[model samples]
Target: MKLSSSAYLRAAVSLCSLLAWTAGAHAESVERAPDAPNAAAPDAAETAEVSGDIIVTAQRRDEKLQSVPIAISALTSDTLSGRGVVTLSSISQVAPSLNVKSYPASGDTLSLNMRGQGIADSGQITKDGGVGLYIDGFYIARPQGVLFDVGDPERVEVLRGPQGTLYGRNTTGGAINIITKKPSGEFGGRVSATYGSRDFVRGTASIDLPAIGNIAVRGTIAYTDKPGWVKNQGGNNRYHDFGQLAGRVAARWTPSADVTVDYAYARGRVTTTPAYFVNPSFVGSLPGYVATRDQTWTALPLPESESNFVDHQLTGQFDVSDFLTIRSLSAYRGSTSHQFVNYSVALTAPTFPVGLTGQEDYRSKQYSQEFQLIGEIGDRFSYTGGLFYARETGRHDKLQDQFLIPFNRHVISTRWVEAKSTSYAAYLQGTITPPVLDDRMKLTLGARYTSDKRSATRNSLVNGNPVEVNARNSQSFENFSPAATLAMQWTPNILTYVKVSKGYKAGGSSEAAPVFANTFNPEKITSYEAGLKSQFFDNAVTFNVTAFHNVFNDLQIDFVTDPANPAVVSTINAGKAHVNGFEVDLTIKPSSNFSVRAAYSYLDPKVKQVLAPAGTIFDRLRNPASPFSVGDDVTRYFTLPFAPTNALSVSGDWTFLQFGENELSFHANYSYEDAVYTIATAGPAVRGRDLHASEPLERVDLRLTWATQLINDRRARLSFFANNVFDNRAAQFTIAGGSPLTGYVRQAAPYSEPRVLGIEANIEF
Candidate 1:
């Protein structure tokens, strides 16, 4: 519902000038010979023996996601098990510029936004997340456990903009590459089970082993149990429940073939139960509020959450000859979390017993090492050099038990935050081609130089002494982040590109900013991109488009230092901002059992400079200190938060019916979102009372399949699924938790996720 970027630049200059005038009327329109002037190609794996685009590693090598000129998306594993994506927050329903959002009182992890960047209160363990989550080449330093459970997936590349030279630093709102599905020495197995609707149960299993001598092994296990739908207090228990168990094991050794090795072990556990801040304006203007906005509304010592993680990884490769190649990655990770939240939804217990309950405990550990050197200096250019190291340590503690209604007293606040970080990076990238227009132009340049040393500490206690909180222990940052791209292969299937990148994110320390000691710096992004990767008539149809613009400097913001005390928070540096976007990905596959896909995204956020607090000006008055007003420049009511101005996803995959080898398929998906704000609206009277936007959603997913062959030559499937199919209840998140000085402006929600229907059985051996 927001579509004018000059009609998307006149439909991308009228489809690249009508595909360059029909490829110059196809007099055998050629142009695909590039690679070898800096070299870098070959490293396939996109099934069907490759070449339908989608073979990515988003620049750390393995090209062909339309030659990787940024703006990427790849979601296979049969399109994420046909749209029922498991975890990673359902992959944003199909990656339309991604946006994940769920911080359920710090439990199930999630809160990633792409286009306009993200992170507005995302399970902060001394923050640092502008999208960057990698697994398989490890690096998940936080966001809890990144929603664990991704048992069998062999693809999930999202990389949109600013990957800062082959993923360095926090990727400035981009990077997610999951890929998990290694170990292929031969024999295999898979199993799946499901049952749904609140009492939902799920199971998954996988195993593969057959190389015996050169070694090969794989294993996976997953389990999920769901319960919960509100109700707590007088209902005994329940409040958005979920439980999970996940596991992974792997080993592979090529032993020759120029040496290759891999080792992995992963473990996971997740549990949940918090969600009910449901203040529908306090039902009847607070007098005797009675539960009513879903889940039978109740609260009190009933919310609980837990997250767990463990991973050990190692990967190595060496060829040393095809122009030299060597890569290695090592990792170790550990995590633990526990939350006992009840943040709201109290039914006047014994004279408003101030229900601000929160108990958190988190612990983390990490170690990473990476080294890469992909070579070629003779064939044109092709180069990559890397060295990265990471070290992390964390411990967070929170315990608060409310009741202070204006000091009629009862407190227990206790908090202890600790963080330690050390990082070092050195990267280099080069790509060449330019021998003339015959090489179809290519030029890539990259850089990364990062050095960070972060340290943090926060200590506070209430009834047991120790108070003073405005803290920081250490901080040091350095960044380089540079990139450039200029591609053009204009016709073996068309390709075009233009890019410029720089991204960084360092800043640390802010367990909800203890009374504004205010220390922030290190966010800086400068990106510009242009894209088009096409295919027509013969490849059936695949179109990709992108257009982006970003520029934000020190833009970390998290406000509400007491909007009537919603846990009094603060994190700033909200100065200078910009975002512009456009993206579209379409697929058509006209034959081969029918297929259709669509994805769209468009965002535009603005706010150019806004660092206030000296003399009031950017009016956003509702007075809880007028949203920190002072001397203009809250930049016209800044509104970037989760950044969501139009997002869409459409799907279709039909395979009517086949007989010779038995088959039947159908999958449908529809996703839409356009309403996002998620907090922060700084001027113009607080965006005319913007109650922390969010609540424009549409979702639907369906699946039906039946592939057959089982009985030993295994390969079977039987499914039926339905997710959110019609039970669309909005409120994807909105908060301002009432009380505009008791004038009550309402809003405090967290909804979405209701309809569920299931039946699935899968096997593959």
Candidate 2:
């Protein structure tokens, strides 16, 4: 159905008004001093008072999110808890531009795609990451880090667009900054217990120590578990795999009024639950697809696997004087995972092309360190300059067995590969609050020089025996990136800004024989953006809107193994592309009893030019006068995967007085995704017939929380929250052309833990 322009305009206005009212209405009542003890913690009374300003380092300095020129979204602890955003997937429901794909084999390993750009695997041993994810200003080079649980974080700042200069390492898209809660001196904390259906149980505790001279400490721990939704069809308690244990410990020390030290350690592990392709032959093509087969089609029995992750962080800051502060950070992380699958390749039938059996083992180790000084050159200017360094090493091994290989069925073929990479960079950024214009205008500038080195080796092995290999390569490059931004506060409550920035992603080593060499070039993006932020109606509402255009060059394109080669897949440069989009966020609190938050993102992302080999699949899809000639027209054939063109989200909460101090909050969401190709393939020939297709889907979510606080102090409270209240089954993606032909599929990892009727209670003595 085509929506009229007028209807679109009306929808936009309605969404904006709803968001502005929720966040602005009660903001005036909430007043938090910067030096207040444990001020970042959740307190219903405080939240009901007023919406406080969100301080962020988007420009490499502490400034109000509304006043900063960059496009960003920061979720405070209250917002996080209220929305039940415990995992990245849940967080995506609030941030429309972000999407996280989970593999059943490795729940601990997340594949994050922001603005439709990101690595497809956690095991990928590449030096560059799509979206730079950070915790306390330290970079996380692998997607595995995004899988961690929220461990008493003060806030999470999601900066949209490239941050190549201020944030080191890989930030081709942007960055996610997680700021953990610091230790407090008031000496108090809370313990909470939660119980839900499916044997779900969770416990969390935190405590702050009394100030010792000028220093104090706080520690937090959390644990949770629940039974899975998938049943083991074969019995013997083998098929289902669910969420596992996750934990963290953090501490802070402030020995002097001007200095502070902080540290934390975290780990998470989950049993992998792999999904199988449902053959259309047995399941039919009906809207409600279901399998009719009685036995698992893969060659091997169901496989159980696991993915684990660990992280350590240390930070220190010292005030050299009244106007200068120095800071440093050190972090180390490691991850390991394994997966085994009996893949099929039939589009409509449960049939394994070569008889089905595949196993892959992956591991990675990473370390990073950074230092910076944040202070003002004078009262008119403030600056933050830093240096960063990181190293990562990983190994991947895969074994395949095709039982239907005529007489040689028992002989299994395998590929083993190892890769090591390291990266280092130094950067500087400054925000100049010029005396002119009476501090109404600011200029932000930053730059970074980064170097990446990589080496890899691949060999064929059988039964732990080495076979033959053709080639190996090692390469390195040093790149420089810079960015600038200018902003002006038209009034105390309104701000406008413009920015020009560059983004870079490093190359990697790929094992393809003929050595069908796979070497990726550094991808870069030059982006231009403009935005507006306003707070009106007595601060009862906040609204922000931004538009951006990005020019991407030498974009890295992942390669798929050429079926004929079986041992090699070559990477290629995608030439150039353009991405233009608009994002808006609103928060409104029309009255103390009602509030709402809404966000929407629309992207017109397309490939401007594609440099591909003649006749190489993609050419057929986008026929042109000359295959090598550059063009401006980008059709559906060139669209990127997981990059939905339009996204809309709405969430609201209502408090009723008749409920006797009880609060019932409900959240609902609707999303739309355009069609996209799953892979590059000769659709008909490769699949025996047409197989690949785009996944267009929509899902609704509803959550309700009922709670009451006991003890006039409100230190003790109880509430119940449920997610996926409707249990809608929607497909997020499908791995087309996988052997079993039944249209190799990967369902939208079932919204397990359905209708979680749970109760949570917290108490403090």
Candidate 3:
């Protein structure tokens, strides 16, 4: 279900014109519902009413998803539950403009990329991600523990493109807003259990209490245990085994109709074995060797990676007057993790060759406070303004990596790193409708000013002596990001808008490469977009399309330096880059019993210039040490990390039968990702080939459910699910490497998960 960009655009324009001819003959389409992140309306019942509409908070205020003037994909509670989505990566298939993957060495860490902009090295403590992750208006500074299940949530909003005014910091790419269910004064609860292949088991429970003297509370708990499928020939350890337990408690109180307060405390822990890396064919085909590619068994033992986190949040809202409302959000969060990762293991050989391994123990804590004012000034004007502040500190001790932990170990390197940052910001946004064209056009303007201060110190000891380099200890920055949009209503069912925005990520020293830490600058982007939102055939069909172009300056890109020292990595600022893309999503609900959704994205990214310091490693054709280092412009060789040329997803839900207090339904989803290039390995090793690009991936998932009413009038359901139905396991990442002894070049490739089959049972009261 893919269409050419030009053809799609033309068809959309033609359809809008044809629909407008009869617009006056029909009443306005059903209310455009929203997906509000700040409001905890369980199941979206309190926010959206129309069958095809969604309530959303993209502008920090309740608005319809179609009316936000931004590209967004809302995953509602029903969708999440029906699809059995348990982790952050599970949403990437439905979010066309976004990409989520496990970090290089850790199985639970996350790497997010939106429209060609994201962090290449999330393992670096000081580096910030281009995309921001938020939980009920609270920002999570680190990626650890984000993959755990959170029971059932109200909705998750994925906003694509620069969101500088509302979400100020590190949003050059986009943002993800995760909103859990809020408490209702009525008593209700839910319980569920699931069992799957490979000994996978999960259980979850949640309860809500009746109101008592204007107070209400809710509690939730969940547990998951799954043994790894990849077996180890020796030792009990296995690759990808995972176990997690998480819980949360939330409360709300209201003394008067005008005042309300909410609080929540949550904690969670996840433990996992590192991913099993496969040896490339080149290295495995050598004299008297065995390749691990697509293998089910390994002689090398993999270690475990574990992370724990605690979070606290408080929010207060006040109605100052009939036209204005004030709100404040405060939060404190902390996390710690211990991981020993092996990128690639050359196993089952006559002589065991220990692969590259790294061990890290890290802890971080952050506190944030935000205040917002949302209201309309008059019949023609509306506004949203806010102020924000945050502080974060992190420490990494006993950080070192080389060959196997104990076997074939050579040079022992150890390091201790500590970093901290403080931030302040203020922002204002407003919308105005002039007395022209029958008030069908509106203009919106917004801006934010942010200031950040950072300090970092690295003390590395080789064998016993501290390293010689004295890294610069501190840095500060100030930024002003602005946004503007013009939206117009052509017909009751058609809306169009054009917008421009700016965003940036703060600069910090690379904790791994102290000498190059102060050598890079903050990365920034200016984005322009034009979009169309429309519904045809009396609200039965909906279509949304957006075309975007972004200009990037001082782009931060990471790469390994000196193959002999793979443990050391550096981040440098590439001078200029540009990304152009388009996104299209459609939904058709011909009847209440059946619905279908499809999304597609296309991207074309090019590197316009490469900075001198970054070019040496980014494109070796210009490096003095390379044999092909003299021919083409650096742009000819480099591509952004995790950005694919084309991505598409299609999903359908059908309720085919109903019999006396019983129901039956089916759900199916399919997604495809084009090949992507991320590794920045050099020229001679590349041999004029695009070895950096990984193979394309295809996924299919299906589910069937049966529901019935119990004798006591409670609702229950039973379901069976199958994921990766075809078992199309493709290598997600591949890289060239060398042993610490040098000249023994090797290759590393990691594949995706295999097929999974499971059954689940659930009940609600």
Candidate 4:
């Protein structure tokens, strides 16, 4: 399928008209701001505190959320703790805009999709993260960091829509900003301990030193562990144990009334995690040569089969004069994972066993330094600008069991691939707001340019003998993304905005097949969005709404030459696609004793144009040599993976003053995905059919807690939490043509955690 330039331009014009109208509507109304009952305003607290926007640097400045016209949701420390969210994957139920999927065979990597845009890596080097992740303003390019547990955080800011101008590289869907607690002058400390099912144990502690007029220090640490869930064929799933440890220290110094400085550092690591399946468990089809259940799932042999990750972050802030301030942030992240898997490949019933194992090791190191100068030079005009520089190096090595299978006496096949890459980027963004027009409107524009370089070398050897005759290749490319936003504040509590932006993913060499040796080109997206936020009924309710459309070009896709044999796969530019959606969040507090928050999202995603081999028939076949044989007629189709068309989440906490000020909270969420097809449509399908392309699912979670003062100012709480309370038989993953024993379709899933009961205690000193 092909789209002409004229048609593309007409669509762009329509998008622009929609944005303009939405912005105009927001400019006609005004509303009040939500009250922060926990902390006083910065001016009233005797400090230049952060704003109540919950999350910012949105629009490049510190402004009240009600005063900014962008759509954003924030989870503060208290919110995360109340919901039992410690990692990105766990937060999906609370944040309706994001979905995280697990990779069955690879324990070290997890795939993430947001607003219907994402790509799962298949031995490539194209840097394919659709949503950008920022830790205190530093970019994390690798997907490894997205799966780690970093413990309690100061706040998580989920900005919806394309943020290309401010955050460079592949922010086609949106961005997630994680902000850790910073040093403050207050002196105090808290420690908490918790225990639950699956041998779950967690501990967290934090301390803040009292300030002596000028300086203060803060420190934090946390730990967690969860036992295995899958049953092993040879034994219990003893190897599924996983845990994380993190620590951070920070300091803030004020030498004078006009200047201040802040610095901090943090680090963390993850222990062994279970990789229990060869493919999705519910896909209903089986590929030849795979196990029906977990076989190699057991405790590691001296921890050699465990996956681990480590990261260190540093940041600094300086008040460079009353009218201007400068801030800098930097970080280094690294991870390594190794796992041995089980597999079977023949499509025969009562699948036979094939001892299949694979190993992957990746090391990614990144450096990012950003400097920002913000100030108001005159009463009529205010401005902010920043410069960012980042450098990253990645090295990956993968080895699978197919290469070790013995073909002939004293003969073994080889399946080993390696990827190494280095990338650098520089970006700048600035926003201009005029003091005139009663400060009712602002115009912001920005752009970023990046250069990406990659090189890969693949070698196959059979029993000390070379098979592919030494294959080597390399490629590089450059990309530029630009953005613009128009916003207006009609009232203190209501604001509206419109934005247009472009998103980009780097290009790199593909290792699918030796023929053609194709190099995937850069994928780009143009997006338009309109959003509104307001507080009504005297701050009792806060509501936000957003609508957007995105057009993708030069979409990079992995094409398989032999659908029957997935080993012979390659990459190519697959034409175009589009994504349109709506999102809303509403929070209502009828009174001080009770409050409730709810969120929902609706998305319509489709493939506009997809190219493939002509007259391909994707279905089961038995013969190989004939032109119409099963192996030669493999087929391909365009479909979205892991994208739920509609999602709804509702939660709230109510407090009682009569019963020792007890607090009770409950939360639940449900997501519905329109079926998604797995890899190849025509071939040995997953689960005896094609992968679960169009399937609907439902999940529910509930938790209740009771808290009150015990003795010596100590606090005690009893809690009950149930995940997937109904034990719904929803599949967690789906894979095609993975194992011979499991058939072409395989499902290795993450069942919902069973019901759990726990007790918590916290002490203040």
Q: For this target, which candidate reaches the highest lDDT against the unseen true structure? A: 3
Clashing pairs in 3: 33-54, 33-55, 34-54, 34-55, 34-56, 35-55, 35-56, 621-629
Best by TM-score: 3
Write the residue-wise lDDT of candidate 3 on 580-652 in tens digits: 9999999998998899999999999877775445334333542345433422345444557678899999999
Evaluated at residue 163, the lDDT of candidate 4 is: 66
lDDT of 2 by residue, 1-765 (tens): 433324433443443344334324433443334465533233222333255666766555566677778888887776776666666666677887776656534445566667767764445564455777778777777664345344676677888888777775656777787777666554555566677776666656665555555555666655555444545455322323445455566666766667778788887665555544445443443333455222233233656566677889998888899788888888988887676654433232233224456777878888888888788877777777788888888877778776653344554778877788878888887878877887799898888888888888777876557675734678898888888889899899999999898878887755543342446678888999999999999878989999999888986654443433323444566657788899989989788667787889888777666555332223333233323333422232344555667777788867654365556655555554454344432123233212344345445555555556544233455666656556544433354433211223332122223356677766642
Which residue pairs in candidate 1 collide? 37-380, 37-381, 38-380, 38-381, 38-382, 615-631, 616-631, 620-686, 637-683
* Local distance difference test values of all predictions, in order: 0.72, 0.63, 0.75, 0.58
List, residue by residue over 1-765, the lDDT tens digit for candidate 4: 323323433443343344334333432331212232221112211122332235356555655556666667777776777677767766667787786555554444556678876665532433566777777666777765344334336667777776666663446677887766665555445666666776677766676555555776777676666655554435533445555555667766667655456566666554544445434332344333233333333322223244455566655556666667676656666665554443333211224223344555666666666666676665544555566666666666555444222331233445444555555555565556776678888777767766776666667765667877546667777778887788887887788899888877766655556443456778889988898988999888999998988888987655555544555555566657788999988989888667788888888876666544321222133223224333331222454555677877787676644454556545444434444444423223223544434345555667677766643333555656766667554444554444321334433333333345555555544
- Residue-level lDDT tens digits of model 1 in 1-765: 323324433443443344334433431432223332211222366453354556777666676676666688888777787666887877887877898866767547678878878677767777688888887657787877554445477778888777766664557888787878887655555667777886677777776545566777777777677776665657545777766666788887776778788888888777776666566545665556664546654435674577888888998989889888888998888988887777654422233446577788889998988889888878678988888889998888888877666456777889888888888998888989878989888898988888888878777888888785635667788888888889898788888888888888888757866453455777898988889888889989899898988888878766554544556666667687889989899989999799898989999888777665431222245343455455654565566777778889899999899997688989999988887867665334453345667678888889998888844355778889988788887775676544322322556666767788988877665
By lDDT, rank the candidates, best first: 3, 1, 2, 4
lDDT of candidate 1 at residue 346, scale 0 to 100: 47
Q: Rank the candidates by TM-score, best first.
A: 3, 2, 4, 1
TM-score of 2: 0.83
